[model samples]
Structure formats: C-alpha cells, structure tokens
Target: MRSLSLLLFTFLCTCVPAQTIAQTVDTLMEYTAPSATITAYGNEPGIGTAAPVALLQQEELTRYDKSSLLSGLNRVPGVRFEERATASYRIAIRGASLRAPFGVRNTQVYWNGIPFGEPGGDVPLSFLDAVNTDRVQIIKGPSGGFYGPGTAGTLLMNTESIHQEGLFKLAPRYANASITTGSYGFLRADATIQRTKEAGTYNQFRIGYQRTDGYRDHSGMDRLTLQYTSTFRGQKSGAKTALHALYTKLDYELPGGLNPEQYADNPRQARPGSADKNASIHYHNLLLGLTDERSLGSWKLESALYTTGFYFDHPFNFDYKREANLGAGGRFALRRLLRDDLALALGVESRLQYRNGQNFTNPDGTRPGDLNFSDEIFSRQGLAFGQLTYTPGAWDFHLGLSSSQLDYSVDRTFSAEGVTGETEFTANRPVSVRLAAGRTFDFGYLYLSRTDGFSPPTLDEFRTNEGGLNVDLDPEIGTNYEVGFSTSVAGKFFPSISVFHFALDEAITSFSDDRGTQLFRNAGKTRQQGIELAASWRAISTTDKAIGLSFYTSYTYYNFTYLELERGGTDFSGQDIPGAVPHTLNVEVGIDLRNGLRLDLFHNYTDAIPLNDANDVFADSFHLLRAKLSYPFKSFNVFVAGANLLDQRMSFGNDLNPQFGRRYFQPAPGRNWQVGMSWTAAPKR
Candidate 1:
C-alpha cells in the first residue's frame, strides 16, 4: 500500500501541466491584501486604526521553515512564542506570559472569526499546524472594549480553508500535497483539496499528520488532524453562510524540567524519575463552527456559533490524571452606517464550559493505583460591547465600551474526605472603556489611544493540582496608554513604531509548592512600559522585472518592574519581572529569482531573562540563525531548511519561581535540518 501511494503521488507530480505552475506561485506570493482593510477590528487599514496592530500575511508565513509557527510569530515585536519541547507551546503578547505557566493565557484568540479561547481561558495553540494558516493579526494591549475582556491582547487567525481569493477562485477545483522529513526523526505529510463554483459556493478539506523523536529523552510526539470548511451565498436572500469543522489526535512525551547539574551534564537527558514514571500526554479534540452574515436595508448583521469537545490523559512523576471537557459559545454583532462619515456597532459574546476530572496515585505513572480525587467543574463568561466610529476629512475617531462577567464552581464529588459539596465564585464585573483618534497626513498616519480592562483567574488557576480550590484570587485590573506612527518612504520602505505604558493592580503570577504542584496568586501591583518598531523594505519587486528582494525587521525593548510586592518576609518592590525578556530583535530576508529559485534567511536575538523572583538567577542571552532554499519546476517544488544553525544550548522556556533552586530550565533543541517537496495543481483561468 505504501509503494502504491508513492507511485500515485509521483504520477500526479509528473503529469500536471507546466504553464499553470507560475500562475499558482504568483497567486501564493501575493502578500499585501491581508494588511489592508480585510483585517479584523473595524475593518480599517493599519494606519487608519488607532490600536497597535501587527499583521503577518501568507507570504511572510511561508518564508520560514514550515515545521512550527514560532518562527513567523516571533518576527512581530512585543510577541513571543515559546517551545519547551516538541509539540509543547506557550504564547505571550507583551509580558502576559507571567500568568501562563503552560499553554496560552491572558490573550484572546480567534480562529476563522470563531473564539478559540475556552471559558477556562486556555487557547489550544499546539493543535494548529502553522503551515495551514494563511494570516495572523495581533492587536496589542487591552482590547476588551471590542474583543471582550482580556488584559494581554487579542489574536485573529485565519487558516487556508478560509479562501483568501487567489487559489480557489481561479479554478473550479484545486489540489496540493507535500511531505517533509528532518532531524530528530521528524516527519510530516499533508494534502488539501478545494472546490469553488461561479454561483458563490466553496468547499475545502485538508488532512495533516506529523511525528517526531524529540531531541530529549521521553519527548517524542505524534499528531494527526482533519479539517473541513464550506461557504454558500444565498442568491435571493443576499446572505452568506460558512461552516468549519476540525478534529485532531495528538500524543506527546514530557521530559520534565531539569536542574542545572542535570542539564549541564546531559542536556538531552530527561529529568530524574521521569523516564521510570512514564511521563506523557494523550489528547483528542473536535471543534465545529457555523457563521452567517446578512444585509438588512442599511444595516448589517453577523452571527457565529461554535462547540468543542476534548479528552486529555496525562501521566507525571507526581500523579496520573484524566479529564473530559466540553464547551459551547456564540457571538452576534450588528453594524449600521448612521451617516456617510459615521458608523455604529454593537455585539454580544458568551461562553460556557464543563469538565469531569479524576486524579490517582501513580505507582508507575501509566496505571492508576489509588483514587486521589475526582471533581466536576463548570465555568461561564459573557460580555456586551459597543463601538462608535466617526471619520471626517483625514481624521478618524473611535469610542468603545464593554461590560463583562465571569463565574465558576467546583464540585468535589469524590475526594480524600469523599462527597464534598460544590463551591462557587463570582468575579467582579467591570466596565471597560477605550478612546482613540488617528490622523492621516500626506507622509504618514499618527494615533493615540487609552484603554481600561481587567482579567480574572482561569479555571486551572482556581483549582490546583493538590485537589483543592483557591478562593482568595482576584482579577487584575489595568490601564494602557499608547502612541503610534506609521509611514512609507518612496513607496518602498514601510516603517512603524509604537510606545506604551501599562499599570496594573493586583497582577496575577504563578508559583510551585514543594510537592511540585503549581498554584497562582495576585501580586500587589506592576508597572510595564515598552517600545516596539517594525519595518519592511521592498528593495526590488517583481514589477521591476528582475530578481526580487525584501527585508523585514522588528525590535522590542521592555522595562517591566514590580511596583509593590511582599512574599515570605521579603519585599520585592522595584525588582524586574521574571519570565519577561528585556530586549529582542528579529530580521528576515527573502530573495526570489524570477527563474523559479528562492532563498530566505532569518536571524533572532533575545536578551538575558530573569528566571526567579529574587533576580539572582538568569538565563543567558542567545542568537539563532536559519535559512531555507527552494526551487520549482513544472508542477513540483523542492525545499531545504536549517534551524538553530549556531548550535547554541539555550533555555527557550523557564519554570519561573521554582521551589527547588536549580529546577528552572527547559532546554531547547540543538541544531536541525529538513527537506521537502510539494506538488500543486490549479486550473487555467
């Protein structure tokens, strides 16, 4: 069967027409549209919007190695993506990662306009394949006034199945397939099929699979995913409907955090007792979504509904646990043009989640020995938002207001004491407000904005691994002030800069107990300020009819400190925040030879990071270099890439405020390389 499949793929690659390949490549290379008004948030261009918005188009996404999304995301200033190990991911916008021990927190994420964040405040970013994504938009700072209550920021992600008007629209049917293999026993394969008709109907289906023998012991991973999307436009009603469905099965081993001695002796070795304990995670998830849009005279309405279910099985040195989670949510919005220069919008969003969890004593980590605890958890969140926009001449004005509430309960059906009743907690409802104004001049655009919002504790934070709840945790309230400017030099060099200051009361942070159980608490207050700069230059364009060259760079500088905090008889006031880097710089260069050959190079530099609250321990700064080269002929394209070319030993993610002095580092992979080929078939227009 394997031989037959390989033969079929070879035939498809060799039998396709050559004339259409250039057209397909050109269509995929188009990059300027996503940064335009099509971006979320008021459907306005970046210069016209008062917020600090960063956009990554498909062309930028494809410029790096396709194994992970971290490379592309880190290119944006004030944003960070951490890879603790293969298939393990953590995302932070600005300095929000302080509250996230694992996974994604504080930030709100949307996939294809559907809220990807669950009621528990976790976004499953590891389940997504970066190569399958078409675009990304990050709105920095508190965006609760329009995107719901979030103190970190907001993220909007659109996958390839959404159809960005180039591939599917050019033909009735299109197909593409690719396979990749790399170091550390890495392998990946994927295929996509799309169909579109002139009657305004479209459908797309995609499947992907990946596996890897990770760099460290007990860090292997395997994943398989399936996705489908469909769209239809009513001919008479003048309405549009879209459906999206996705399923994923993922399994990964956990090597655990290593102390300094263990890391220096053997960087590739798993933590002590980890291998004997069978530390690993098994995950399965399914998500479905539906969206509809219609026009009523002078008003427009948009609505979306989504549901998700997931099963998680984890084994660790401390215990073995299993959980099943279910969630559902909906969003609705109405937009109207009150006048030619004025607009009004109103929206509502809500989410609900339920979980059944069980924990047991792990004699060998794989099997449960004794029932430790079992609990049922429920959470709900809701928000109502409104916005008004007025544009006169070359000036733009925006006012946004929102109110949000959250509640959760824990029912300990079976515990050490057995049959514990439920305990509920209701968070303080807050009213969020945002005001902004922008002006467009002949040479550039300038804007100033202020926002106020709050973030509450997540379900995981409230319920600790010790099978108990923490009821004293409170929400973190913050205010942000920002100023930004963007301009173009000679229609080729694009540059943008933003500076902001954020003050928070009762900031949330994490700590671990002596038993290795993670917990959360509110710090007194924090003051964070930062500067971000991004620029792009098209040195040579295809329109010039010669070799095309482009360069892009982003830089970030942060001065984050604790304004007031007291822990364990120590005053930590005026200390730098742990887990937040002070400086970062990223640069990339893309070269396209008109003759079907391409080259891309990327460089990243991160400053030393504080690892503990005392500010005595710090992770060393590091530099990384990567490059990729590809060539296309007829209908097939082949590529080769390398990562971490410097072979530097660095801790990409740190376990902050560890109870044990030395157990604070999660070393990243050393050096790696990959090669792959893809075949695409598109109809002639």
Candidate 2:
C-alpha cells in the first residue's frame, strides 16, 4: 500500500501543464473509430485468416458509463465474459478461457501501445476503467505468430486521441465532468481535460473514482485511475509522435464460489471461510509508452516502445502471494507501395518479462504467515512477419508468413527449511502461414483463408510444481481453415457470415485437486468448429435521421470437443470439451430521432456449458436483456441504463472442474439500473 502511494505521488508531480488544440489528427487501421472505410486496413491490419474484427465507438461504448467492461464486449460476436465481481473480469474469445476459471488467459490485451499481460501470460482487468477508453477492437482467433502465443485471440483498446476530429480551432481546449449513481450502491465520478497549444500537438488528461457495494456479500470493489496522453508532430518532416502514461489502484473482495446445494439455498451468500479470511487482492498497475510514425519517399515507417509493471498482494483461502511483475517490448514495421497494384508490409517485435514474488502459508480462515517460498519467472518472445497484397480491379489476393520464438523459465531462490524447490526452463519456436483470396463488387465480397496457431502454458499452470516445476505440459498448437462472405443490399442492409474449423495437438486442460491447488494437463487431441453470422438493417433513414431505425444482430455456434484423451486413469475421449460453450446469440435495436433522442435495446443468449470432463454436470442456458436511453441538450447529456432486465438467476463465473464442489458456482448479478449526466465546454476561436 505504501509503495503504490509513493509511486502515485511521484507520477502526479511530473505531469506537465497542457495548452489548446490547433488541428485535427487522424488514426489509421482503426476501422470504426470515427471513420469506416475499406482502405482503413492501413498497414497494421490483421495478417492471417482475416481474423473477424469488431470495433465499437462513441455511444455504443459510452452508454454503459464504465459500469462493466463486459457490457460492451458482449456486443461483439464470439466473445464472452466471466464476471466473479464488479471489475474482476475474465474475457474469452472463442472459448480461449476454457482452462481458466478466472482472469484472462490464452488471450492478449493492449492499450495505448502497452500490453496488459504479465510475464507469466496472465492479464487482469481490475486495473482498468472503461471510461478511459475511446474505442475497442477485437481480433478473434489464434494469432500466435503475429501476437505472442494465445489460442483464443487479441483485444485492442485505444484511448481518446488529442488529435481527433471535432477538436480543431473551434474547440481548441475543453474540460468535462460527470457523476453517476446506480443500483447496488454503485457510485462513480470522473473529470477529463484536453488542450492543444501548437500545430500538430495536443495533450489529454483524465482521472476517475469508482466504488461499488456488490449485490452479494463480501463482493465490494473500489478503484482510482489517472491517465495522460500527448502528441508531438514535426512540421517539416511530418513525423508524428505520441506518448502515454497510466496508473491505477484497485482492490476487490472475493466472495468465494458455492456448491450446487449452497447455490440453490442462498445465491447471495459468501462462502463461510472466505468472509472470515478477508480473501481479496490489492493491486497497483503502471504503464508508459512512446509511439512514432513517419513517411519515406515511397514507404511508411511505424514504431513503438513500451514498459509495464504491476504490484499486487493477494490473500486467499489456501495461499498468500506478493508479486512484482515487469515487462518491456518494442515493435517496428515498414510498408511500401511498390506499384499501383502491389503492397508489402514487414514487421518485427520483441518482448521480455520477469516476475519476482514470494509465497506464504495461509490457514483456512486466517491471514498469510510464514514465508514458505520465493520464486522468479522470466519470459521472452520475438517475432518477424511479412505480408504481400495484390489488388487488380475487384479482385484481391493476400499472403503472409510469421515466425516466433518464445522462452520461459522459473527459478526458486529460496524455500522453507523442510520444503525443496525445483527450477524449470523451456522454449518453443512456432511458424505460421496465412493465405486468402477475396473479391469485391458493388453488392458484396467473398473470402477464404488458412492459418496456424500456438500457445504455451501460463505461469499459474506451472506454479503447481509440488516441490519442483511441472515439466510434463506442452504448448497447444493448431491449424485453422475458414471461409466467409459479406454483402449489402441497396446500401441499407448488410450481412456477413463465416465458418471455421480448427484442429489441435496437446490441448491444455484444467483441474483442481483435494488440496485446493490448480493444475494443468495436456489433452491428447481436440477440435473446435464454429459458424458466425452478423447482420444489420436500416428500416428507416433520411438525411437528418440516417439509420434512425437500425437493427443489428450476431449469432455463433461452437462445437469444441476432445478427439482423444486419457488422464489420471480416466478415458475422457469423445466428450464435449468442458467450459467451451456451444451456442450464443446477441441482438440489438437502435433508434435515433431528429429531436435528439436515442433509445437502444439489446438481448443476449448463451447455451448450457459442460462443467466437467465427463460431461455429466452442466450450467444451464441463460439469456440477458439490456436497454439504454439518452437525450442531448445544448451543453450536456442525460442518460439512463439498465442491465439484465429479466433479472434471471444465472452464474457467469464457473469453476471449470472441481474436486469436491468446493466452489463451482459464482452467481451473476440481478437487474441493475443507473442514471447519469455529462457536461462539456469548449470555447470557440
């Protein structure tokens, strides 16, 4: 706690005063952020299998008022969220979280050019506030070769840019503030300011405070966040540079899981031992980065350097831990237009991460004590990839190749007198290829692709060394083939559909033992196949009320199962892979009137999921209904929002496979509501 405060004080002292904006700046490769153009691909677009991408901007993002990040991500296809409590989030892309009961694994997240993941391959969302984001992008599929290994996919979060449109001389400087209160005793307050003093330069700052007394016992959460962004551009060279820094303090209580009987008895009650033990986590996260973009005679160059670290103290039922995570990385890319019909892109990236931590002994209902072990973990990754695209008339052909090397090591510096510790080291080099062909016409386009993926076990999966390191586990490797097409009718209706099949070797599986220790094992073989569809129609439109009567929806069918497996004297072959949901659907209806009023409605449904490898236990199917309304005034905005309007009894967090049903169900919140107002000011030139 002291360390976090000291760091916070030091950072606040270094903030430079900002001025007013002079011009508008543009962002590339971000499809829906203020502009959606076919050429938005820019240079950094996805390189393989044309991973389905989704982007949310403006109202689609701000309506939730940062209450729950999942509320926004749920609108995207092939995405799911496991929420154990407010701000404690686990995001799954195509069932990538099958092995993780909590936290984000097998997926990578980035914000303002900095990675949210640690050296151990785990990314926790507790340190982030949704209000700090301006746009969100998701890439669905294993992009291991291009984005460090993760079988699931990638999430890209972008901050509000100081150089965006609507911030020119007319609005050279501005400040905004908002306060909100909601059901379950949720409260939030925030302030933001932006300025630009010189041409092609600007600065932005934001700070927020939020607290929530959860719907269940012992599930309260609170957070504080501060962020700063600046941009500097060279007038003569036309070089653009951006800098970002962020710090956040967060701590949340853990109302442990419940067994089936306990769940039916009382869904809002905390586990007996959890309340007395004060099970919770206190975390402090810090991030910094610098990015540059420039243009050569016939080529463009882009680069970024970033550093991130976090300090956390966790006290749980079976163990206690204090962790210091540090990581650094850089990326460089060059793209050239060799000819009118040809384009080429080459990029290289490298990352290094290290974690120093200590583990202690904790009794069933007491605080941590007795330093039992001290360990250090190290991870390094490097990738080089290239892509070529040819365009002639309505036909486009693309090919890409990437090679990556990932290394991991864990060393136990000290251990209790009676316990022996073991050190482990390993490495994997994976190569991937992407091939796709597409054709576009006035009405639509068609595309097909093939790609490969690879992801290794995370640090949590290795911590159960039982004295030494768990060395029997291998990485999950797979190949995917897919085909898709999209079309539009009369410029008012749009639809897209895709189908994919992926086969894996040495798939990772999760399990917990009687001693309360989590473990990971390799399943012999597995396969995942799914179909996804998305569509939008504009029933009413005019110059002033464009897309006023618009409706959009997305649906998915996932059949992920084990092809063969034998572990712990159990033959679990041919069973539906536990934790991987089989079906999901989302629907939304948005209406905008010329009178400056907006109303949006949404619905989501999820099919039952297997809770065990034997496929005997299950979590029933569930659906959610949500709505939001907003009205704009001359200087401020008024809004109201509600989630899970049906107030159904369901559980979003599931204990993948438990030994004695200790904590297999963590209930979801019932219906909730919030109302807020926003005010903005910007003096004209």
Candidate 3:
C-alpha cells in the first residue's frame, strides 16, 4: 500500500510542529462553557440537554483500545465504521448502514441509561470497551429524540465515575499496558486504575482482553471485560450518588462458504470438515443505577433509576439458541433559569421489558439441531417531555414537546416427538412526536450554526417475528438537516464545518425463504447526505518551550436507495441501497516531544462497497497506518506501538452474508509490537 502511504505521510510531518505548540497552550487553559448551553439543565460536565456539538476529548482518544472503536470514532465528522468480521462492528451517521444481521435500524444506543439496541435494532460493537470510555457524545439529526425512538443518528457512550473525596484515599495512580500481534492471530489487552481527592470523591477501574485466530476459515475470537465505578456526596442538598458494574465473555469461529472452485483455492481455506458449519456465542450483562440532586431558590431537581440484565447462548446456522433479558428505566427533571436569557425544562420517562427464548432443530433435518421450541416476551414505555430555551442576542432558541406510549406481549410453545403447539399475543397504542432547532453567530472570532430534528416509532413496530403476532407494521419516521461552522484562529487555532440531511420512513426489511425461515418487511424510502471537516493547531509554546500540534480530517458520502420492494406480487422501486458507502477518510497527528517524548500518527481511508443487493461483489479502496511512542519516569510510564504498517488486504460481506476473498479479511497488523509500565502512590494530607 505504497509503504503504508509513505509511513503515514512521514508520521504526519513529524507531529505537525508539536501539535501547533500544544494547541496554543491548551486553548489558553481551556474552560469555556456557555455557548448556548444545556446538559439536562445544570448537571455540569460539558453542560448537556441539547444544542452543543463538538466534544470529544481524552487527548483525542489515546490511540484507542478494545480492538479500536470504529477506528477512534472515524476521526469525527459524520462518522462511518462498518466491519462485519473481527467480532462485528458498525456505525454510520448521516448515512446509516449496519448491513442488517437481524438488527441496527436508524442508529440508537445508550449505555449509562441502559438500552443498547437488540430487539431488532441491532447494536453490538462487542459491547464496548474503548478503554472504558469517559466521553463520546455525537448526536446529530432528528435531535436524537431524547435518547429513544430509533435514534435518527446517535452515538452516546459516557462512562467513568466514582467519587467521594477519593473514598479510601490512596494516591499514586498510573499504569499502562499493551501487547498486539496482528494480521491473523491478533491479540490485545488493556488496563486502567484511577483515584482522585479534593473532597470531591473518586475511583475508577477497567480491564479488557481480546483474541483472534482469524484471517478467514472458521474465523476466531475470545473476549473478556470488567468495569466498576462508585461515588457519594451530600452537603446542603448538593447530594450525589452513583454505582455501576459490567462483565462480559465471548467466543467465536464460524466459516461457512465454498463453491467457485472452493473460493479460488484458499481465500485462507477452511471447509471440508463442515460439521454443520460452526458457531458458538455466549453473553451476560447486568447494571443498576440511581442519581438525585436538589435545589430550591433557583429551582433544580434531577432524579434517575435503572436496572438491567441480559443473558445469551447463540449458536447460528444449525440453530441452537437461548436468550433472556430484563429491564427497567426512570428519569425525572425540573429546571429553571427564567431570568438569565430564559430556560425551562420538565421531563418524565419510564420503561420496562422482558424476553425469553429457545430454538433447536436437527433430528434428521438438514442441520440446526436439538432443544425443540419455546418463546416469551413483554414490553412497555411511557414518556412526557417539555423544554424551552432562548438567548435573545445571537438568536439562540430551542423548543421541545413529547408524548409517548407503547405496549407489547407474546408467548409460544412446541414439542417434537410428542407433538404440541400454542401461541398468544397483545399490542397497543404506539405513538411519538419530537422537534428541535438551533442558531448562533459571531463573525470575527468565528462561530456559526444551524440545526433541525425529528424522530418517531416504538411498540417494537407492531410485533411479529414469532411473538405477539401482529405485523401491521407502521411507525419509523425521521428527518434532520444541519449546517455548522466554528473557529479559534489566534488563540493557537481550531476549525470546524458540517453539513447533513437524512430521511427515513416506514423502513424495516428482512428476508429469508426457501425454508430458511426469517421474514419481516416494510420498505418505501431511505436517504442520507453528508459533509464534515475539522482542524486544530498550536505549533509551539514557551515556558521552557513545549512543542505541540494536532490534526483532523474527515469525508463521507453515502446513498442508499430502494424506494419500494415487495417480491412475489412484483414491485421494486429504484434499487441500489445495500450496505451503501461511497467514500470515507480519517487522519490524525499528535506530538508533545520536549523530553518526556511522545508521538502518535494515524491514517485511514475506505471507498468502494457493495457485496450485495445484486450489485455483484465489490470492495476496493484501502489504507491504514499507525504508530505510538511514550516515556515518563518517576511514577513509571513507558510505551511503544505499531499496526498494519503496510499489509493491506480487506474485504467485508453483506449480501446474504458473503464474506470471501482478500484472504486477510481485515489484515493489517503485520508489524506488531508492545511494552508496558506504571506505578504511583500518594495520599497524605
């Protein structure tokens, strides 16, 4: 790949003059809140609630961890990341496409508040592990409809909390580790532990493990994860409380494909002993939460409650399934600012869900063996919302209103040799409505904006895939438009630009016949538009002279068209719209070398896609490069890194699952390396 694109353009030209002098002294000591703010009304932390874009820091995601989260958020700007192998991965904004694997519809995922897809809205990025995240909020279009209702384009992952004057106070916190051997036997591990004190409380923990023996042929993978957080405080109604937990394990190896001369003699071959193909998966998750805040003189109240659980054992193709889930949700808010530029918010939300399953078949049948049959399901939802904000000066305004309700039910049974059957149902009143807008301006110092939104759909969209039978499908609507601009210039430098348009209506599709079973249909319209650009600079700073420079780049153009389709009875509209991807690009550069040496570089590009929709397999355009180096003594700190260097060979499938060719699958880890260190201890007032 042209020496991995000339060693990532010579490591971003030697780290762009020390990341433009440390982003002009870190934007003059950072801290600049209040630019048309919102954060669910005064719960600080980058102020939330809506109308605030551009916030993705943690040193721009320390070169990513956890098998890379969409290659570090696709370097921002209308993001895009879609990989079906390597434990599957997906993300698309402005032009969504997860190529359906039974889920991923219109993007919608939330962790801190539970509900992370799967009930047909597929969202399974190996269940997260971007070094245990602390921030990642990108809500564009349809104003993310308050976190529910088929997210018109959303990606919100915030985790990292545990405070209480540092609890058992024990300072000296810092540790780092990494070991990667890429290409076809990929392996990874990550670790973190933190503590803080100043009467604000704190504690954070994270651990991750990964394995890969894939490059094709029955692919391979094994994974593990763990996380914990805690916090507590109370002093004159300034109360606070939080607790969180997570656990995971996964195993994989399923290679099913042949014919065409056994895939041109070894696309990394693995067939012959196809014992009913192969597949095995197991998963488990649990979460509990509670939060509260109080104030009177100026009116402020916040409340939250949550409980969630999930278990799974999925054996594909030859069928062998067992699933379980339990859920609970709650939210309440009240805020007031009426005097300072006007502001008001009132909210209510509720959620409940349960599901059970079983499926087995093989006894003389052509695969998918054992267990017989069973099923169960139940669901509920309710929401009431109100919001208003105004600024007067720069014409900053926002308004919102919502009313929602949904209910569902299902049951079934069946036994083979002895013969038995039964099924039941229920579904009712699913409704939705939401809206949003924004505006800002300031020529010289640069800062401009324009926004819009919409979202609707629920009640699992009229059930029927083997439960609560009722396929009267209707629901699923979205609309969004945007325009943006930002600047900083002299204070070192920063730049931004954005443009978008998206549309979806009654869109839900699934197909599988000829006795393969799997059906669900509803299609009519789908659309996506895009544009995004970003920049950051500093060059160098003095205080003993510190060098710095940061860079960012983005590009995305996608289109998925298929106005309508209804087989058998004949009806097909425009066509073209199966895993759409016209172009994608990302660039990164970082350097702080002034003694404690540090350097980072990255590059990625993807174009050409269409392995299905009868577009006849196609996948071209590829580039990747990475590097990292770090050093810091005293408390202990050391590092080294490399990836792909230049071993490009990529291929992804989607037309009825056709993953073949380019033997490396996603191979690029050819130049492997890693080293670790960390030690800290300080707690004595």
Candidate 4:
C-alpha cells in the first residue's frame, strides 16, 4: 500500500504544477430556492414532482472518496449503507432495505433522465464511479406513482453542464486530470474533458481507473469505467435533447462474513473457505440512453429511450454461475397547464428483459464440476399513469393513479444432466392511487399525503432452490400515509420534519430451508411507523465571508414490526422485523478558511439491529468519525481525507439472514486515509 501511494504521489506531483488554471472564490448559502417549484417547470414536467428532496453538488462532494457512493450520499437524511467488502454496497432509503440481502432495492435510479434501474428496481451502484457524477438529486418518497414501482425513492445523477459555468461570455471548453492514492493499496486516476459550442451544443467525456488491495484477506478490487454525455437544442424552441453512454468493468474479491468470536480474535481474517474457494465476481455493464423534452404552447412533452446490458461470472464456495442480461425500455409523458393554477400529466412506459444463465456444481470451488442447472428467463412490463396537480393560491394539491403489469416466463433446459426441461409462467397486475396536498408558508412548506406502492419479485427472487421456479410467491404491496413540514430561518438555519405510518401487506421475507438453500416467501403483514428530522444552523461565521462555520444534523426514529405472521403454524405476531433500521443520527460541521481552504468533520451513529426474524441475534451498534481537508490554488487543488478515525472495530455491513454459525459480520477498515491532487482548465474567473 505504501509503495502504491508513493508512486501515485510522484506521478501527480510531476504533472499538476504546470497545468493550473485561473478560478474564483466560493462559499455556501443556507437556502437558494425557497418555494416548491418543479425543476421541470421548463422540461420533463411529469417525471419528478416537488417534494422533500436533497441535492448535492460537486463542490460539496469533491473531496470525498471518488470510487464509493456511501461517502457523499450518507450525508443525506434517511440514507444508510452496508458493505460486504470493498466495492460492495447495499443502500436503504427510508428503511426500505427490508429484504435486500445485496445491492440496492426498492429504489429507482436515472442518468440524464434515462431509467437505468427501470422496472427491475435494482440499482447498479457498484458499477458507478462517484467522481463521474457532478450533480445528484435524491427524491425521497413512494416513487411508484411517478418513477415506476420503486417503493422507497429515486436518484437522478448527471454530468456537469458546461453552460452552467458561464459559457456564453467566457471559455467554452475545460478539461481536468486527477490522481488519488490512499491506504490499503489504493490508487486511482481519472480524466474529464468537456467542450461546448456557441450554438448551444454540449459534449463531455470521462475515464477512470481504480484499484485497491483491500484491508482484509481476499478482498481486493479493481474497476475501470468510461462515460460520455452530449446535449443540444432541438429544432423546436424550448426543446432540448441529451445522449449519454456509461460503461464499466469491475471485479472484486468476496471475503464471506465472520462470526462474532472470529471477528474479535482476528478482525482482518477472511472467511474460512474464502481463500480456498477463490470466491469473487467479475462483471461488465453498459448503459446507453437518449432523452428529449420540448414545449409547445402550454403543453410540455418528455420522452426517453434506453438500453442496458450486463454479463457477470460469480464463483462461490458452493456454486459457479454465469449470467448475461439485456434490457430495453422507454418512457413518454405529456403534461399541460390548465388555466393558471391546475396542471395535468399523462404517461406510459414499457420495459422488456431477456436473460440467459446457468449454474454449475463446484466441488473443489475452482472449475465447473458438472452442469447443475441452465435456464432462460424473460419478462415484459407495461405501465400507464396520470396525475392532476392544482395550486390554488397558497395551497398545492396533487392526485395521481399508477397502474402496472408484468409477465414473466422461465424455461429450464438442463439440470444435473438428467432432469427434463421444465417451464413456468407468471403474470402480475397491480394498481394504486396517490393523493397529496400542501400549503406554502413564508418560511417553507407543509405537506400531507397518502400513497400506495407495489413491488414484484425479481427473477432471482423467483428462482426456486431446485433451480426451477417458485410459482407461489406474490408481489408485496404497501399503503403509506405521511405528513411533513419544512422551514428556513434567516437564510442561516433550515429545518425539516416528517412522520409516516404504513402497512405492508404480503410482505416478502426470506429464510433458508432444511437443505440450507435460500428461499423467499410472502411472510405476512407488517406495520411500520417512523419520524425523521433534519436541521442545519450556521454555528459561526464572519461578515467578510473569508471564514465561515456551519453545523448540520439528521435524526431518525422508527418502529417496524410484523403485525401478523405464521411459519409452520407458529404465530410470530408482533416480532421486530429483521434488518429494520430503527435509529440513526448524523452530525457534521463545516469550516472554511480564506484562500480556498476548507475543513469538515462528520460523526455518525446507528443503533443495534435485529439480524433474524427470531429476534435473538443482533449486529452491534457502531459510531464512526471522519474528517476531510482541502485547499485550492488557482485551478489546481489538493485534498486529504480520513475515515473511521476513531478506529471503531465493527462491521460496516452484516447479513440479516445467515447460516447457523452466526456468520454475519463484515468488518470495516480500522483507519484509512486518502490524498489526491487535481489540475484543471476551466472558465475564466
């Protein structure tokens, strides 16, 4: 690790000194947009509505980890992460990660208006490099009514727009190159170039590489990515079009979880069979999309086309599997303003997926011993929805209906070399309506809403232990009621609070069968209620703006329980839901010094969580403290950051449902540090 860091430093030092560009000074304000105004008042009017949302920009996240998503997104309220190892992350928005054993579920993700998550509702986050995104908008709510069937929330990420840098009067092009190195054998390099023509055309491209010899045995990771974005004015006035391409190649070693005693004895040890089994994952993913929006008189139109594909090879202790997937989807919406106070929107979308995969037996955990199962799966989804929004003076009202259907079919071609072909088909149709009303105050806004959401099982969730299909599982449905209010004081303090209650019918939970094969079942009904609050106050500052200080905090409290449930005729009523995140608190302080130097301190705390439906096993609570320092000179910059400065010995992520050995802990690095340098050619100050 030390050698790699030294080499990276030498290379960056030799390159950055000669390339610095001129720039300006900067600081942050508490609030900019005081009222609820649709970002789409100009385009894509129906895609995202006004709600309790969070926006983070490059300026705020520039110093964080360039390869990890949790670094920046964790600052937002009601967001948390679990990591099985380096480059592996599971994120939950508003405690929506109930049954997601891996990756992000119950959330939708978009890149430049293109739905990458689509109807499958699984976010490809590990494939995304944090530095590639210049802006992120997090919409926290039941997203089924607007962004497909995601019951938790939605994320929109986009590259920087050159026009926003004062392109009209100044330079129309800029480029930057950066190098970063850190503890645990980390090394990264990235280059971004952008150009904008005077005729309203935009183009940007980025390429990055990351490698790390992780803290634990058999946990190394490496990734490479390339992304390009283009935007231009359409032939019609008030119309714009955008095209985006993002490609990633990633591979990571998987060190399975550790038991409690094993964790305490040797925190840096890998799972028992991890090294011998050579467990790991290698994958390639690509996203291509085009988005167009236009305005014709009082009506606005939005449309998008996207195609995504991935191929992966996963080798574990018991199975060697390979899979390939290809999917295509598009969305269309037409919204019109009624008179001056009312607006109506209608939309429809379709998505199709074709997949081919196979599982092979692994006795020695090296090569394929024999064909265990081979299958082909396909799914088709259709959605149609409409919404009516009315603003009568200070009051805002919205009502919407969302209806969707999916058809899934599977064909098993081979199993154990002796099994005959088997086939199964499933069709699911789910519907829901959403209603909301809010009033604007001089300080902020007050809102209340009732919504319904639906989520269907994914292909992996539908596969049976015998490698055929689980034809009995049903879609999980939820009904939500929430009230929220937000306010800002003197442009220095901002506060928001919300309370919510919900009942999830046919809640889908998971358990292992007698043969130790994982399975999914509709466990029964669950009830959840929660309160969340986020506030920020300028603890200290100066009139000259040379030095400033601010403090921000977010807190959440929730009670999620199984209201009614039965397993093997044993009534497990009123049991705490497994993996339910009950309490979380985050506090941050920002300090800025003159001459473009800054310091930030962050502290996060989470309560212990139940790890099983039986509620006896638990993952212990943990606290983390992190810090970052940065200084900018001209267009050249340097940053240093450290994580887990307190050296907390605990799991960063854990398995909610595990085998009998209590192997749930995925230990985090004790203390890690990173240093980076960058040089840029940017618009004139």
Clashes of each: 0, 5, 38, 0
lDDT (Cα, tens digit) per residue for candidate 3, span 1-685: 2234234334422332222333333322342322222233233332223342545544465563336565566677666655545566556555534224433455666565444554334455575666666466666555434555553456666664432223223322322334444556666655555455434345666666667787666667776666766655665556666566766566665453343455545555554433343554667766666666667678787677777677876655545666788877777778887877778877776777777776675343234576666656666666666667666655545565555555555555554445444333322224333333334444422222233232323323344333334446554565555556666778666776666555666665544433333444556676666666767676564344677666666666665666665555745556555556677777777777666677777877777665444455555566767777777654345666665567665444332323333221232223445445432222222
Error of 2 at 229 (Å): 0.5
Best-fitting candidate, measured by TM-score? Answer: 1
Show where candidate 2 strays beyond 4 Å.
Answer: 1-33, 37-49, 162-165, 363-367, 417-422, 464-468, 542-547
Question: Is candidate 1 or 3 superior in TM-score?
Answer: 1
User: What TM-score should be assigned to candidate 1?
Assistant: 0.94
lDDT of 2 by residue, 399-483 (tens): 7778776667777788886554546656465567767777776767777777777777777776662334667778788888888
Best by lDDT: 1
Please say which candidate is ahead in TM-score: 2 or 3. Answer: 2
lDDT of 4: 0.74
Error of 2 at 505 (Å): 1.4
lDDT of each: 0.82, 0.74, 0.54, 0.74
Worst 10 residues of 3 by lDDT: 660-669
Models 1 onward score TM values of 0.94, 0.91, 0.31, 0.91
Candidate 3 residue runs with Cα over 4 Å from true position: 1-73, 77-87, 91-106, 109-120, 123-147, 150-214, 219-276, 280-358, 362-366, 374-391, 415-493, 496-643, 646-685
